[model samples]
Structures are given as structure tokens and as C-alpha cells.
Target: MRLKQGSLLWYLYLDKSYCLLSVRNVKALVEYFHLLDVHGKNTLNDVLFYHFLHHVTDLKKRQINLVFDMLDWSAVGEIGFEQFYVLVCILLAHQNHLEEQFMYRHSRTVFDLLDLKGDLRIGPKNFEMYRFLFNIQKQELKDLFRDFDITGDHRLNYQEFKLYTIVRINKLQKRQKKTEENAERERSLCSRKCRIK
Candidate 1:
């Protein structure tokens, strides 16, 4: 539940080639769309959508609604193949540990998703509802707002959001690097101990 920086926990839980989908991936997704279309409506209602989300992700249930909301743009209570495809892509990206990259690539979409009320911008209030989706803590989000809200109006425009994504990606990379370095040190120490024995 905590967003551990070194793992997928940092982002809304999901994977990566999955990120760079080949045509075959798209074809398989089309088949999946058909399989999930139990009502033959070529759309997924909240029920079907929730089921699909549960099928792919390991718990952390609430984040699903935010994602579902992102896809259910028309507020029609149903989503079509396109939206479903995007959701799957997001899942794949997260699963492959490519969330930072995915966010960077799809910043606008993410910004729109965060701007829950169709507002031109996003602020802490909007983020509070979807915070579980990113799993950020109160202090971290406060830091984010303090640093990124360039206009000091307590909201983020698309450009500001884009900058935030870049900064987030950098922080993730740094954390991953530090984790790798620590693992290498552990391995090196273990080898030395083994050789000494």
C-alpha cells in the first residue's frame, strides 16, 4: 500500500514491450475486448470494467476507480475499446516497471486524469481524491505542490504537470540507481565473506 520508491509501488500498480506494443499486441487486445464484451455492447460498464481491472492488478482497489474515471471520459458510465486499450497499456506499463516512462510519454493524459473535475488545472484537492492512485504521501504531495506550483496559485497547468512528471521520473531513476548500488554492495560483501570462509 505504501509507495516504495524502488518498486512499482511508487506508481499506480501495473509492466513494460508491453509499453511499446507491437501490432500483435493490439490484435490480442482486440480479442480480449471481445471476450470481455459479455453484453455484446462493444463497451464495458463499471461492473465489467472493475472485473477486468481486478483481473490484471493485484489489489490496491481504490485506484481502479480513478483509472476507470480517466477512461470513462463521457461520464456515460461505460467505456469502449479505445479506452479499454489505453487502460491495458497503462497496466502493462506499470507491470513492466515503466510507469515513469509512461507518465512522461502520456503526460497530457495523466494531467487530464488528475484534473478530475474537467477543470483547466489540478491542485491538491483534486489530487487528494486520486492520491491513492499514485500512492504519494501527504508530505510528498506538499513538497510537490510547493515546488511545482510555479504561479503560487496552488494549481498545476499542463506545462507545470509536465515539469512535475519529468522531476518525478528523475527522482525515480535516482532511487532505482541507489537501490541497485546497494544491492551490488551486498553482493560484493557476500562474495568476500564466502571467499574468506
Candidate 2:
């Protein structure tokens, strides 16, 4: 909900990779063309209207529009952010609570940016959601995490691992964003605070 330096960085990174497609010559691309509405919604049309279509070449417009339409929620119109978020959560849950965990991790990062504490952990009431997230295809989270080996060894130190992992993730993401933004700004500016005179 609240965007902080860290969250902004994460968004920018994801945006750059998924939306921007790592286009080195950003002048050729529109920024918004890459956001996926939280629920696999039609964010592309919004971009087309607000940013892309005007800037991109005519040939690119038709191709982009077709792709955008296909990504829409109902194929009738675009999906809203909240809906997109929910759909993504549900899919990430994949029949269990993996989606919840993913959101919890994200929420924690948000909290860190706000410098406030929030309870983003899963509780008994929501345990069923986790089960639903991964159990659909006979996937068990316990085994999955075991395989993930959070410690990078063979066992998980549950009490210490995830918290550390999430915090480091948030920090690394923020740093990456700062680095990228600096590079982007430098790339955009042709002169170094010097007058043409």
C-alpha cells in the first residue's frame, strides 16, 4: 500500500525486467508497457492510452495492442490492480499458502520502508490457505522448502532463515534500484551540469 525507497526499488526492478524488457535504448520503448495488473489484468491498455501508443511506432502499436488485449482480465476490459493482485496471490498460492507467504514477504518489505512493525506471518486461521496453495498437485510445502534448503546446506533453520532471507532481499533490491536509477539518469542526461554557451 505504502511505497518506500525499498518498495519503489523492487517495483522498478521488476518493471525494468518484466515490463521494460531490459531495453538499453529506452528512447525506443514506453515505460508502462510492462506492468501486469495484480491479477493478470489489462494494464497494457492503460499504458497504451496513457503512454505507449503515442510514442511508439505505428507498426508497433498494433502488435502491442493485440498483446495487451490478450492479457486483459476478461478479454472484455482491463483488470484492476486489486483484482490483479488477488489473482496473482491465488496463482502463487497454487492451491496452498505459498501465495500468502509471498505476499507476507512483500508486506514485510513494505513495513520496513515505513519503519513500522506489522504482523505479516501466517497463523492458524490462514494455515488452510497455505495448504490450498501447494496441495492441489500433491505438492507439499514442507518438502518443497526442504528441497529449497534455505540454509543452502541440507536443512532449514526455520527460526532464523526466512527472516534473514527476506530482510536481505529487501536491502539488496533497494540497492539495485538505486544503482539502476543512477545509471538511468546518467544515460538520459547528455551534459554534466555545463552550459552550452
Which one wins on lDDT?
Answer: 1
TM-score of 2: 0.24
TM-scores, all models, native as reference: 0.75, 0.24
Candidate 2 has its poorest 10 consecutive residues by lDDT at 109-118
lDDT accuracy of residue 178 in candidate 1: 100
- Cα displacement (angstroms), candidate 2, residue 150, comes to 10
What stretches of model 1 exceed 4 Å from their correct place?
A: 1-18, 55-66, 185-197
In candidate 1, residue 107 scores what lDDT? 83
Sequence-dependent TM-score of model 1: 0.75
Candidate 2 C-alpha error for residue 165, in Å: 2.6
lDDT of 1 by residue, 63-125 (tens): 667667777888999999988867666655655557677777788877887777787799898
